[model samples]
Target: MIPVELWPIASSLKGELLQMQRPQERFAFIIDCFKTYLSWE
Candidate 1:
């Protein structure tokens, strides 16, 4: 589960993902977001 502090970020990411028109684009975006989050840690 995501921490409370990160809920806002998670929510915004979810909103963006839902707005994406293609699965490929969503998949790529998710990967990029994951990479960025990993780098932050």
Candidate 2:
């Protein structure tokens, strides 16, 4: 599952790109990975 705070930003950045407008786009967007890294680890 994906994180909460990152969902919006990821979707937003995904929205910004043409090929990233899909649900699985986050798979390609490093924002998700970055968010995970910046989280309380």
Candidate 3:
């Protein structure tokens, strides 16, 4: 399971991504968020 603190922030960001206009923009946001999460590991 994901840690409590990180899960909510990640989830919120992912939800926010739905508002993005284009697929490329959403993909970039997801990629950036994934990188940020990996950096924390």
- Top candidate by TM-score: 1
lDDT (CA) for every model shown? Answer: 0.96, 0.68, 0.84
lDDT of 3 by residue, 4-32 (tens): 97788878887899789899999988899
TM-score-better candidate, 1 vs 3:
1
lDDT of 1: 0.96
Ranked candidates (TM-score, high to low): 1, 3, 2
The number of the candidate with the highest lDDT is 1
Query: In model 2, what lDDT does residue 9 have?
Result: 72
Model 1, poorest ten-residue lDDT window?
A: 32-41
The TM-score between candidate 1 and the true structure equals 0.88
Candidate numbers, best lDDT first, in rank order: 1, 3, 2
Clashes by residue pair, model 3: none
Question: Each candidate: RMSD to true structure?
Answer: 0.7, 5.6, 1.5
Tens-place lDDT digits, model 2, residues 1-41: 76897799767765666555575774656666678778957
TM-score of 3: 0.71
Residues 1-41, model 1: lDDT tens digits: 89999999999999999999999999999999999989999
- Using Cα atoms with residue i matched to residue i, what is each candidate's TM-score against the true structure? 0.88, 0.37, 0.71
